[model samples]
Target: MIPNSGIAITIDIGDEHFIHAPKKKEVADRLLFNALNQTYGYNTVDYAAPIFNSQEKKNGGIVLKFKNAETGLYSYEKLNGFEIAGEDKVFYPAKAKIVGRKDVFVISDDVPNPVAVRYAWRNWVVGTLYNAMLLPTSSFRTDNWDDAIKAKK
Candidate 1:
């Protein structure tokens, strides 16, 4: 599980022993350094991916604010994997951009009165949002309401 605090890593040893991979030590070392730098407060390291902070409705879209994006927020190429939903509880793909240091503006022509937003909410999602530190953003949803994606089917 991904914790709110601490660091994480992905490892694959195939059919070999757990620590047999040549890169295992390297990966573990990196993870330890990140934990010490980011979690232990060794000069503000942006270790984990950005998580949802807050959001507000703007003129035609929603402005999403983040906390762990101290350096700034970013996206790979153009923004993707964002969706906006209205009171009808239906969601549509949205156009999003980093507006400032830690804010992102998401808009969807299909969702005029958007009441909720979600990012990388799919099981097979390829996350695009990132912080200035180059870490990817975690999957998040704005509300606890029923999932619009599930309702579609």
Candidate 2:
């Protein structure tokens, strides 16, 4: 697991096509800029993407808060890629939105008593959540409880 310290560097390699090959230099430049500004402290920079900070239960839904989101949050397109679950431990696709600055509210009709939430949990997820700096949020799960498969063993 990568620690939340300011020493980490993240880079997005993008797609595998001729059209994207030309963009590699741009991506590398951006990554270098982030590293210089964030890790080396050359200047004040928004280095890391916003990360999950906390959550709260509210009227049958879950409100998620984030750190490293001082500039606020957004999505490249419509918000998606969130899931919620109840005590049954069955996760279902959820509706999510940015509320206030760094808070995301998630809810699912299938999970009325949600106890946990996950974002971009799929193997090949196309996540959209990002900070105002346009850095994407990483996949995250709110619960550490053992899976049902483990419990059944």
Candidate 3:
């Protein structure tokens, strides 16, 4: 059962998010569940907790933005793990960091004038968000483009 707190297992860790992957019993086990069985009664909540997500594309220049990852937690340092693709249709982790409360900035460092931005859009994406109460939101992405670039071997 997915918890409402928005915490999940993935590779990316956002600004105000916490994780305990090493504690998971199985690959499918969620990180939050680790806190449940190992910590206090975390699973007691049967309903969806509040969720916050980041927003993107209010403007241009491949600006990365988040509506909410989970919640309370904010950014510390520049979070790596952003990828941008130009006309080449290649996706590679670009340089990324929290620019402000309403935006994140990303540069391809390889491609200039990038048009679209992508966060941890992967099903296993690791991201962050915060609620109004300052709690972590959850990992999410902005672009759902059907033509997303797949990594080449």
Candidate 4:
């Protein structure tokens, strides 16, 4: 996500030098800008590095290490759409928990040797993961697979 992408606005008008409530249009404009920024993947802070390597654990899970996560990891209070995939299976809903450290997440699924993971990877997705500053994590995937939309067409 780019800096200054998160939308918040302030407007000054009229000659009154006193504090006043925000106008409806001002509120609406702020909402619209924020919604658009999120929709365009410009309002969130995502991983600083790609998932270059994955380590399989004895418990049938994989460990993923992320950079730029020193701020701590958190999930949105109500949203969940994390997934994992193996060579033989497609991406399926899975569970991920921050383990050992703030930047290390362990993803567990039924598949053996999980090869890839993804989060909020959809057109209408709203971010489910956030950093300590409450910035959302942009949609991301670890696989280099062909674009699903283009493949379908």
The lDDT of each candidate is: 0.74, 0.75, 0.49, 0.53
Write the residue-wise lDDT of candidate 3 on 1-153 in tens digits.
Answer: 665343443343322334455524432344445456445566543222223244444333466444333332354345655677766666767776545454567776566656555655565544443333333334444546677775563
TM-score for candidate 4, residues paired by index: 0.54
Estimate the TM-score of every prediction. Answer: 0.76, 0.79, 0.48, 0.54
Give a tens-digit lDDT track for model 2, residues 1-153.
553234322223344343343455656665766777756877776677788999999978999999879889988677888888889888888899898968899998887799899887765566688889877788888998677211121
lDDT string for model 1 (16-132, tens) is: 334344556644664765777756777555465577889999988999998778788876588888889988888788899989668999998888899899887775555677778
Ranking by lDDT: 2, 1, 4, 3
Error of 4 at 60 (Å): 1.3
Ten contiguous residues with the weakest lDDT in model 3: 45-54
C-alpha lDDT of candidate 4 relative to the true structure = 0.53
Q: After superposition, how far is residue 117 of candidate 4 from its true place, in Å?
A: 0.4
Show where candidate 3 strays beyond 4 Å: 1-60, 68-73, 123-137, 151-153
Off by over 4 Å in 4: 1-58, 104-109, 147-153
- lDDT score, candidate 3: 0.49
Cα TM-score of candidate 1: 0.76
